[model samples]
Target: MKSHIAALLLATSAVFPALAQTLAVKTSAPERYVVKKGDTLWDISSLYLNSPWKWPALWQWNPQINNPHLIYPGDVLSLHYDSEGNPRLSLAKGVRRLSPQVRVVSDKNQAIPTLPLAVMEPFMRFEQAMGESDFDQLPMVLGSNFNYKMNIEGHLLYVKGDLPRGGNYGIYRKGDAYRDPDNGAILAYESILVGTGRVVRTGNIEAGKPSTVKIESVRREVKPSDVLMPISSGQSYSANFKMTQPVQAISGNIIASSNKLREFSTMAVVVIDLGRKDDLHEGNVLAIHRQSPTVIEKESGPSYIEDASSLDKVITQVSEWFGEENDEDSVVWHMPKEQVGELMLFKVYDNISYAMVTKTRQPVRVGDSVSSR
Candidate 1:
């Protein structure tokens, strides 16, 4: 019996050594620091961590700290020791009591108070169908030949042409003058007018024989040897103008917007009417209006729908502003889709874009009127 017991004890001890080694290797070390006002997780990671990408690891280690991105002045960070004496990060409130060996450094690099990224949400501008009057008039090719044909409506004139090596072409209608086909210059459409047309398609043409071309439609008459080239589609007509900088309404309107109210997609782009001309610039923050509920009462009998109580919501939340001038009419705003919301602007642009809500908790459609606070 004694010999048997000794053998069992030896086997148990052998298993214990393997488990111990595994536990020791799995333990992690703790890092502690004192939080100063204006210190953000982004700044702290930049200071200590070898790479800023490790910020998520630091955040996970310190789960107690709410709003990891937001830190107040004078918060204490402690590293907790595991059973094996491994250090792990921990957060504690109040003044930090330091030991002699630990040195506290003054973090001068603080985070600046700015609007959240949610405000500059991207928006999609669905292109309207091209009209007949918007079709190109001239058909010119650099190296390759082109086949041209008119649509049944007589509004559109299509051209099929192979582009020269690295050459491009744009389509334009003749207004009041004729153009010199060889020199690639415009004389006049109808002898005294300039022409305009909308670009229906864009693509690269390989150097080769011309392909079949068909004009979808046109608004005016088209002639042969018209000029075709590339130009900007046009300016966006947006009523939505998000304020980038704060404005003290001495005598104008004050607008606010929410990031949740904007609809943003990968290719979507939002344009605001505010810009340098409107005294708005980068690093500006603004408050957005929360959507409100609208209730309609029944006058005589039962309503058509079941739930007569109309659902209403308010737009609340502040968002940061980022974007540049889009054109003479508006400024382009770009942000991720998740952050779009309702916005309110204190002012409006004269004959230009206005701050409007493109999305809402409820059915907020285009052309809805928005006011500033």
Candidate 2:
């Protein structure tokens, strides 16, 4: 956990010099504010800057302090001008200690995240992709204590499969199959996040049954045969918001949206095909484009052509002479591609990544083109 925290701290180090020159400070921005629990960097930046995405530009890293990116409850932050008249946020002086113990325990050492942690916490905790065989092999609820087919919160459930003693698992039902929007290839099956259950007993598998789980939390109806997978424990929030251009132009389709929404708009979560393999990562912003409809030119008889044989003979002679045909072919003209939105990738997987819709001129939909900004 310490190393993970350190890695996140290191990620917040760099700032774009060009963005600093164009920093847009809010007219009504507060001069100073106190950090608090659950205060995201985006939230704080929005309070001061018109464009919250330009946060790194105005953040002043204090080399004198250790882990400058780690801001916590009680640390005071104030906006001030540097020697060159550029605006910068500075951390106010506070209690200091030499020992590592004090530094670790101090409020200032707690790292702040770039986005709201709550937005991604449920996904990180309950959502996972599994193969069909793996999903079938997972422990499942056999029946309810009351013999109810559908179970709700506080219900007792009997599960059958290999059991790990005293572990909590998320109740997942089979959801939609995610497919590549560009080529219609199946990507993976999305597990429905139902609820949570805690193992109460490890029944003997030799007798053809094992494990009993109690439904502790239910977002939807829990039922018999619901698969149980262990919940993950990790921080899903990020602290980096650097905007970078792709090394090469990239284009992909929005395969799916969060919660299986059919249509998307600003602030919606959309999944795209680009990933680490495509040089995409968290903190990269992508532009969404909508292509224009195809147009086909109407064909009419050539103005001076009277005989079909004469035209065919002329075309044959031209082909033989130039090794190419001089035939009147249909032509198509297309409208310019229009930029519809921008998305910031927050979570990345192997072949897919999840991004939040940051800005949009129109409602983003499935199959919309996503290109690098």
Candidate 3:
């Protein structure tokens, strides 16, 4: 019995030290820091903790008196140790700018955002997903005013279809279909927003009357082939962003990105296969793990080769020497996927979510899988 107790104590000591290592505070961490404008959650968290994503663990939340996630400029954060000997951070009340008329300002406006709003701007509120049939049903740009051969911003347009009076529409072109890499099943169709316009006059196709619209903005030249979708308004972005892990384990692949670049780094927009059905919500931080591009290991199924172009070049050279074309058979050692970066889910759909690459150790690519582990 004494031997068993001794072994148990040894195990307990080992486990606690590992836990402490994970929740380790950086040596350079500040004891107390004043929150300032233009500060991000990662920035402030990194000032006191080694892993910024583990910030909630360090936060000493007071459910009754404070909203731990909403910290504004001028707030004070102080480091303290809990009774259990784990490090914790406590927040002090902060102030915000008031209206000249003494009106109560919104807490979100004063609260520091989770990330730079500029990094998430285009992907958060602007992106829209639609079915292929819905894309087909949208009204097409009929022609431009004054019979101009090309259409640009601030030009008038004629559209033939049902349109609501005073509705704003985005002129779009169909983009790539996001498909699950595991099974070639399409998850969602991407709608690329190129231009926008406001309805000046509603139209009736049967009545032979076309709707009049004034183009307000254009990313690409407005064309007749583009489809019109209503500019979605309301609750697009959240200033009170909080980082939380998903309720359960999530495994999905990186299907697409907003910039269309093959290789991207921090602040790039990425789309994942997991979504509302997977119980993922906004501000959920996930690890982006991909197999190292330099190493490809033998596996039962196909290997996940990220940054394939570079990997292919390496394999091609090896093949030339060995006289074999297959890259998989050339490599025999196993390499587990390593965490290259982290992303925070900002927007979620029925079967997909939009995330910003918040941190990176290597350039991330489209085929890399993500985990909520």
Which one wins on TM-score?
3
**In candidate 3, which residue pairs clash?**
none
Please state every model's RMSD to the true fold in angstroms: 24.4, 9.2, 9.1
User: lDDT scores for all predictions?
Assistant: 0.33, 0.71, 0.77
Window of ten residues with lowest summed lDDT in model 3:
295-304
Give the better candidate number (1 or 2) by TM-score: 2
Which TM-score value belongs to model 3?
Answer: 0.76
List model 3 lDDT by residue over 159-189, tens digit each: 9887988999888888889888988988888
lDDT of 1 by residue, 1-373 (tens): 4454345435433633342233221123225567654444434544544323223333323344433444444556664556756323446645565769755554433332221212322111221112224334334422212333322322333344432323322334333222232353432222111233332333344644343233333344344544454333453333222222244321122121223334332211222333345443332222223223322233443332223333211111111123222233221122222222343332222211223332244443222232322
**Which stretches in model 3 have alpha-carbon errors above 4 Å?**
1-22, 62-66, 93-108, 146-150, 232-236, 293-331
**lDDT, candidate 1, residue 207?**
44
Q: Higher lDDT: candidate 2 or 3?
A: 3
Report the candidate with higher lDDT, 1 versus 3. Answer: 3
Candidate 1: stretches off by over 4 Å: 1-144, 149-244, 249-268, 273-277, 282-364, 368-373
Model 1 poorest 10 in a row by lDDT:
311-320
